[model samples]
Target: MRDEQDDGRGAALAELRGRLAASVAVARLNRTQLAARAGLGRTTVSEALSPNGPVPSAETVAALAGVLKLPPGELLALHRTASAPHVVGDEGTVTADGPGRAIEGYSPHDLEVHPAGPGRIASGCGGVGGAQELPGYVSRGHDRVLAGAVSDAAAGRSGIVVLVGTSSTGKTRACWEAVQPLADRGWRLWHPFDPTRAQAALEDLHRVTPRTVVWLNEAQHYLGDRAFGERIASAVHQLLVSPERGPVLVLGTLWPEYAHRYTVLPAPGSDDLHSRVRELLSGRTLPVPDAFDSQALAAAAALAENGDLLLADALTRARDDGRVTQDLAGAPELLNRYHNPRTPAAKALLEAAMDARRLGVGPHLPPAFLTDAAIDYLGQTDYDQLTDDWAETAYAELAEPVHGKQAPLRRTTPRPSRRSPAPAIAPQAESRLRLADYLEQHGRTARRHLCPPASFWHAAHTHLTHPDDLNNLAQAAESRHRLQWAHHLRHRAADLGNTAALYRQAEHRDAAGDQEGAEALLREAADLGNISALYRLAVMRERAGDRDGAAVLARRA
Candidate 1:
């Protein structure tokens, strides 16, 4: 029975291969051409059609069927012998339909039809997932807050919406949902949600698309550094009111002072915040007592570790001098000096920090709650050391609980206190110190060592392990001095399974005289979904013999 089944399967496979070969021939395209379109190499096409061809992968079959303009089901069915019964195992089975399969694209109708489940909730920063519903926006008290903010912005005829709340308060979820309509309306919207990733992307956006709606979530952290903040603010202003690219509707969620300083929108009402919080917790049962207090306690704990009284005095002096809290980015140093000297100001800052840690200030409090002086003073010293101390204190506090109890350590991660940085130094001096600073902070060497005189080619070769570097190398290879180095780097990197480098390596090989090697490299890259590699492989396959195989691969490429 097994032999019969195997033979039937083999015969079916042979029949399908013959039919596919005939179809390619009838199409009047060579194997290489087909391979080029299909994104496969000549050899790959040849192997697939060979008498001892391996069982096709689902992805490969889909690629081939897509290129051949044939139903994957039809081709798959043709591979089953008439004498053998088709059996689907217990594993999840894929059913392929006829040709001309309808492709799914971005559509509002489709989005609406798709079930909107309780969305994956997350906050912009330190907070983890919140209760299913948000506390304010759609909730009674929170609804008022959302409505007030939205209404104020709407009344002012602002094109943007700003939702502000503390961490884990569902600000991210609210903003994400609120912006869906913008996307549906075909408006390009961007967010600076992830600092490390978004900064690079935003730089690209500034270079390319000038006027784009930017929804900045947690705008404070990114703009916390005065220079950095000012640069970003300047960019925002240009996007908003520039003649060349003006009026990019900007909505941002931030602390009150930061919002007022950076945004054109009005503040959201208190009713909205309360209603939203209530609504988010409506369906669910949680210990709602002291919810706000708990957050305050967390904040206070953070404050006590680093902030002191001297910082508060410096902050007051700066404020009295008519400096905006946004500009008070540098007042911490004065506070730090006074506090360390056992001055009355230092005593006051410590008292405030202790109060902040114990009593917890509500979100409704002014930015003065986390004063510029306190933030700066805290930032000047090692918060990490303070954190280490805090962690130790917490561990000791919790140690007594498990002493006589059978329970293991709860494995809780303490909340990190958010502290601002020290005052900025001169730009030129800062730039000169950056390398040493980075090495000291991160314990790593800077990439500047890769290239002397900073040639694109040199930098590319040194960072060949990076795909972007390989791309840079490829582009630089067009220049006389960089060609050999680029090719060499790409060739080495390709061997390490870097797809971009592999594609570049194939190009270099083709430019050199190794057609076969180039074709092979392209095939490998194509299999990994490198479109350029697939395109190259198809061309190479056609040049080599096997017109039928080339035609199939070309379609796929």
Candidate 2:
């Protein structure tokens, strides 16, 4: 009987191995390439593929399956089958008997709730002191819409509710509050984030059952992948339309830029990059305003009267413009820290992060980049006064969370591989940091007209990887009439396959009377599927009296 059991397990292992090998072949990745991409050692990859090897660990299988574009859930199931001992009367069927079994991804009850703010401390009579625990949820206009949608989901109508707003505008808080009742009703909340946003969604979205809340906080991460965003959007649309998947509420939050990108229609003859995303988002978005209006503020004041000191303080401290959400998010506290940093080095570090963010750099700022850029904010006297470990001390101070909530600069863990579940291979000695959302937004206004110094431009050129950011900096440089910097940065962005940068570079070349250079760039952009570039080339051809070439280009466009 033991021997028969061993044979069954071996067969399962062999089946898993065969599936993995086939998937690798289809993906056209050898063991070495697969290992490198998956952030796993080559030896691990080889052993997992060996026919006679033991069942791979769950993480190993997930990493490989993610790299191969196979469903990690299905692959992990196979791994479990091979590893788990077969019990009599135990079948492979999963039943919705409890929270553990019912949830496909993460259980709503298991999620760590974000702090609302400091509650009223126990004081004499109506005295409000320091914050104690989380404050009461102050009702807002969007909350009403969110509640109605949640109610609809409870009543067997699955729908998506996307809250669109800027940073620190309480979009996430609203979504978190909306899904609370679902947890009590045995509804599962699946927030896919293990391997990668797009990969995790593609792998597990199909299996999302009814009465589940698909939490897509920062929805751009899931729907911004050029390769898979449309596919994920299609899957989401399918999830909504399928009658068998009733009572599933797909909730998402998005910044305005991301919302615009997904919803805005392209011009005629241009590629429709976000058609599926538009379809998925059509008529389902609820705009969460950045500031509370008078009516909302009045309601919050009512809540403040009920001993919610956080609300009371926010009401007292809120500017005339009504930045109550930012106050609640410790935005003022973050700014205070920035203004009154313990040391000049710390202040310089904060300034560097703020400048980088305002200049359109991505959220994750490397320590090295910050260190390199911060020097430009300091004078030679200040720089000479710095200790050997000044950078370390400064980062530690700024990265500390204020009010037990937001920080001036928050440390970020190394992200998992884009193609696999495993954490990407990165140096362990230093961590990346991101400026607080509130600071990033504030700096955009405060530093809008300020061009970064030479050191900033140099450090960004050395450390920045995203083409969009490079293009943005290039545009900034061009606006400041720093032509040399603009030319180099724009060229780098174009080289990185940014078609928009290619179009912009062509325009710059044309403006400089370098018609040949412009035409060459336009041709490259047109080949890379930029319809604007094709149209521009058509115009150029017509101007050059190549009527036949012009006609062909126009027709192609």
Candidate 3:
């Protein structure tokens, strides 16, 4: 029996060798002669080709096949000769039963590998790691805010909570850690605009398990831009309020200005600066630990001392006018007007401190100057601006005496009655738009996979620009990897009062060989006073044997 098996295997091997040799012999020779022309060496090729010998490595076989101008499968076939009259190639298959004798079969998908390109692909904003656990890094207070925000979102206070800070200040790191525990417990993560890999995870939010935690890095990109913000806000409202879908908990991180622009909170209130700072600390125990070494404590205290003043003044400016928060980021430069050196010393003090070392040593330094190096070392330029600017603005506003008795309170505004209209909610439009924007730039696939435009604005272009959304959809559908789903989204978008969506539906219709249907959708969109939709309807009608209809639509558009 053993001899019979060995003989069978040898026959197979010899056949494979013969086929490989034949193929190689017919091929042109290169630096290395074709394997068929030279024949395989006894020591190496013979053993590899032998029935009892090990099968050649994939790389080696492929190399040999290349040299011989032969298909590797042909060679492999000879090495495994079958007794049956019908010889099955090595790429064989078998099916298995599920729970019983009945079975289902599946084909193996061969993956093609491609080299990575220059630009970055979005990944779920994993994290940059934390500082408390690492040396040479300060523990930013954002961790507390993130932890608490996640708790709040899970508890059902709906809406996005944005974390704002400077670069390398741990906002992304803190958010990642805070959301991980929640994710393990079944919270899904959604990201819209991922300037980096961190934000890419949002693409899967719709398909992920319910009860999600969305972390949008650079969330502003989605919110503050053009057409993108509108769609995103609508999408967010639809998903979060959907009866079928579970709640989507969101945590967005961005620079302070963006956070100010997109946060649900009102712009920093007069006292809200302190509140903001405390909130940033995430209710973490403050009066910071004595456990911290003295130098570290001093540094923190100095920063706090200065920060409080800046916040108070900034918030006050905001109350008087809406522009203060926008200007706060640039307040240090704004104080250039107040840099007089010889003035009364909240007057001269700041400049003296700034110029003290630069001005050279003097036996008699002015007493008016607040020359504390500690303040300078701790970054008190803005803090000084706060104190001086606040004092100037407060005195200017209040110094103008009231008609009667006591001066009107400096920073207090009486509350309105409950019957008054409440403050308008910050729109979710920007956030939604940003996500769409991200998708348009980055999706690709192996073996012909289709993806929607990552950028919401880009996707909305057809309808938005031409009012022929339906035609756009039809055209898109005709293309490889048809974007039918996007067409659906565009149609629905119009019904939801989004003019851009209506226009897109018109474009989709035109693309589907239904110019009349396209014209009708565009008419409705235009009737809604969507100028772009109206214009597109007219153009599409003119192209489709309806010159008079095009003329009327053109006038309307």
Candidate 4:
């Protein structure tokens, strides 16, 4: 009976492959072209049509069918027939429909959607007449363009749409609203966030099925990986161009800095660090203005008159600032909390978080770092007045929810270690806190000209783990003419394999008359393929009369 079952399965799979091969031939597409168009790996496409290959999944069959301009239903049926005998038990049985079975990620419709807000607003303005939630979204010019893009995706044209704006600007809310219709239309939404954004996308993007929405909130996390960002960009580009496997909508939101990073063209002869990212985002970004225009304010006024008390309050208060979205999101309350903490220690903590954010620390702030840095922001008299447990008290007060929504410092659960391949082990206690987005943005402009104290640098060096942050601190220290601190920071960054830091260290050594040491550092950087390091090495060799070596290094650069 087993032998007969095996024979039957083999014959079924052979028949499926035969029909698929015939379809590909009819479409005049080779295996490579078919794989690219179907968003399948080249090997996957080849195996699906191979005589000795295993039976392909229903999803793969459907993708190939779409690319070949054949009906997916028929192909899916053939795949099921070929795969049925391989099932060993009831637990192993496969289904042909339903998102849980067919799709591999979250659905936007099922998500708990909320409009842009500081946290969650329990009340509108006065405690007596407050809104339970944010006011209704007032459609803006950019929202119309975003909605049109979503509509195009619904019509079977795969594409990416990125909303670029600063924090608290309703970029996320707009995207959430744009994709809501697709959710009702049976589209699957995939948000790749597990071990890490880049890792999750790279690992599972190839298996993404048709009629799916790739939700990339805070898109910088996905496309900002120094190692894997380009690869993810390439994968997304392939997915968009793959005619058969799409009707897929890639929706993303980015802060202005990150948007500029990915979209800006490199200067002439500079290494194209964001080449693939630039290509992926080309002609796809729609800017979201920070403040509403006259037309948008008028629309908000109409909504406010229609019983949106929250919008009414924002319009009245934002008359001076024109930051209607910020008002609705409780930015004023957040600012008030920061400026008027119950204790000086709490205010100092808020200042510390703001400085850390403005000085290039990642969003996840360590409590130890905050505690150590906060003292720098306080006066000697204020610092001397603190109790032994003042840090604990300040943190608790800062973490307390305001307006029934946001806190100055929001506690966040750290993501699982990206280095670990096994299941995540929970931390013994919460280890990190996040500065509220509204506060972070406010500090960028508020503290842009201020240099952080030595205590801030020390806390950051000891607690911060990301190389980028360390490099940024080193640059700041260099600009302040604190060469010793800069050297320490650059060394720390170089230890973490930051090529830019290595190159900078080389320049510093040369400036200090350590010619041999500079050459050694430059060689290390050149070996890691740092373009600037290569050019520097060429210059050093030419100065030493090693013309042949200089020519080789210049050519390599």
Alpha-carbon lDDT, every model: 0.41, 0.76, 0.40, 0.76
Candidate 2 local distance difference test against the native: 0.76
TM-score per prediction, in order, is 0.24, 0.49, 0.24, 0.45
**Runs in model 1 lying further than 4 Å from the true structure:** 1-162, 193-198, 205-212, 243-247, 256-557
Give the runs in model 3 whose Cα sits over 4 Å from its true position: 1-145, 154-159, 183-188, 192-205, 259-557
TM-score quality measure for candidate 1: 0.24
For model 3, how does the per-residue alpha-carbon lDDT over 1-557 read when each residue is reduced to its tens digit?
44565567557656765665565456534323433443433333444444555434333455577666677776655533432112122211111100111101100000001101112322422232221111121244545655666676566544455666543333444555566555545444444333322212322233322355554555555544443443444444544565334444655555655544443355554322222322332422212111224444344345435654433333333333322223233232223223322223233233322232222212122222222321332235645645535434433433232211112112222233355476554432211101010111111111124222222223333223222433344344445344654555455456666666666666767888887787777777777788888778767777777899889878765
Name the top TM-score candidate: 2
Candidate 4 runs further than 4 Å off: 1-132, 330-344, 347-557
Candidate 4 lDDT tens digits, 48-129: 8988765675667878888877778877776655664332323222222212222223322223223333334444332223
Error of 4 at 68 (Å): 36
Better of 3 and 4 by TM-score: 4
Question: What is the alpha-carbon lDDT for the whole of candidate 4?
Answer: 0.76
Question: Deviation in angstroms for 92 in model 2?
Answer: 19
